[model samples]
Target: MNHSATAMAFRASARRTLTLEQQAIGELIAKLDSSFDSACQELLACRGRIIVTGMGKSGHIARKMAATLASTGSPAFYVHPGEASHGDLGMITGDDVVVALSNSGETQEITGLMPLFKRLGARLISLTGRPGSTLARYSDVHVDVGVSREACPHDLAPTSSTTAALAMGDALALALLESRGFSAEDFALSHPGGTLGKRLLLRVRDLMHGDERLPCVPAGSPLREALLEMTRQGMGFTCVVDERGALVGVYTDGDLRRTLDQRGDFSLLRVDDVMTRGGKTVAPDTLAAEAVRLMEDSRISALAVVEDGKPIGALHMHDLLRSGVI
Candidate 1:
């Protein structure tokens, strides 16, 4: 009844069930047979999408399988067996493949729909325990998802059977992936809203100071004039450009402090004499992530955005970090 005893009891119960489930899953993997390969071939050869259906626990597994297949380059979706029996069967097409899930291979709600699938000319792939059962008998490819035991202590629930079904679904998805030669870059496009896509798609041109905010002064400008430009632009630095507007050099607050540190001889320093030449700049098309890495490595706050070797704008880490993209 106390906290310690309750925790101990919970852990013991969890460990026992987990061990049984793992053993059952291990047996299923070792027994994967030719039917598995045939099922993969049937799905790969289909011109249309995969239609996955099941009831209850199998339905939950079917939904995950559908998502996995869809994201991994296979066109697939989950259709509830009960829903399909009513009016949802119209979603299936003759070029498609149907993957039906039922632990006993005799779930009436699931098996009942096989006749309609056949009538529509859709190939059937069954993930079930009993190969001789109605659903398996009708399937063009029957994957023996049978398990030796249930994780349920009473051997009544569908725990181990569902695990086998999910693993088989993953196998089918990955098999289709290898056959189609899917790649990570292709995957990133499908997940364009995530961080991976941002790293692959975002560019320097998309985020940089341009035109009026460049903090540029003419070559003959005095250090005092360049300092005023840096103050007005707040880019932590100023650029000195030739008449053609190509980058000549850069000067930051750091340069200003170091110059003033040596007895304030800044009066003799022209923008051309004091500026740091060949400062780091990036093409407008460079990825924002790559720019961040460059800035971090160089220990600098900003970089010039250039086009055809001419500085057009500036960008700082603050801008990238604030976008929640860094």
Candidate 2:
């Protein structure tokens, strides 16, 4: 056959595989019943973490399912079924929920542990393509992730079945997450090193320049003095404070440019005269992400950190960038 025929055949095969997998997922969604609800309730009521176990390709899917459950609100971890018989069974307990995945539902390594799970009094939830098989027969609740056809042409590989199982796992996790009212803040607590965690967990106080590094001048100080302070601190702006050390205005490089464009002899101008009065300020407790939004919305690069209306610190866009808060 020509290259064109070969490429066309490959594309056709890919399309068929995707169609089969999509159908499998649709069927799984339709088949979701009280059994799925029982599984979710078991997981929610579990005082200990959910223990997910499987073998072969199902094991890989189980590990991912465990990770998804853990990253969301449900505490879960994966244990290889092959390892369960050799002391790993100690990980299971009465308070935990055990979810065993096996498309065939008769995998010896998995079915062999049913009695042990029962003896431990841990609730058993099975995900399988074979609802009538040994694992499902003994399980407290069985989620049928059955697929009518495999994406593989030979109907041998675990293609469509695995996809259905994974989708089912995701559905359960998100449902549980919403039911628990899990917020982005909760997610950030679990992912403190990721970008989303930085946005949700980092506060202005963590990145702001405190009193020691603050660039500011009394409202009565001359523009020249404020400029000098800005230069000294190298923060591109100077906060103007009142007699009580409360922020009254701000003088930034933009203010200087506007003053210069007016062609005035601003050297003698008071900091208050040249400054933008009643400038936007943020509390020290503000989220760094919130600060970034404020800066972007106001078209400014810096903000005066205030507490009880008193100037306490200062922060700039670069500070956020330096700390990876952006």
Candidate number achieving the greatest lDDT relative to the actual structure: 2
Residue range 201-292, candidate 2, lDDT tens digits: 99999999987799988879988899999999988898888888888889999999999998478777888777999788999999999999
| Candidate 1, superposed: residue stretches over 4 Å from native | 253-268, 272-274
Worst 10-residue lDDT window for candidate 2 reads: 263-272
Residue 191's lDDT within candidate 2 is 95
Candidate lDDT scores, in order, read: 0.86, 0.92
Top TM-score hit = 2
lDDT tens digits by residue: candidate 1, 212-235: 978888888989999999999998
Shift of residue 168 alpha carbon in model 1, Å: 2.8
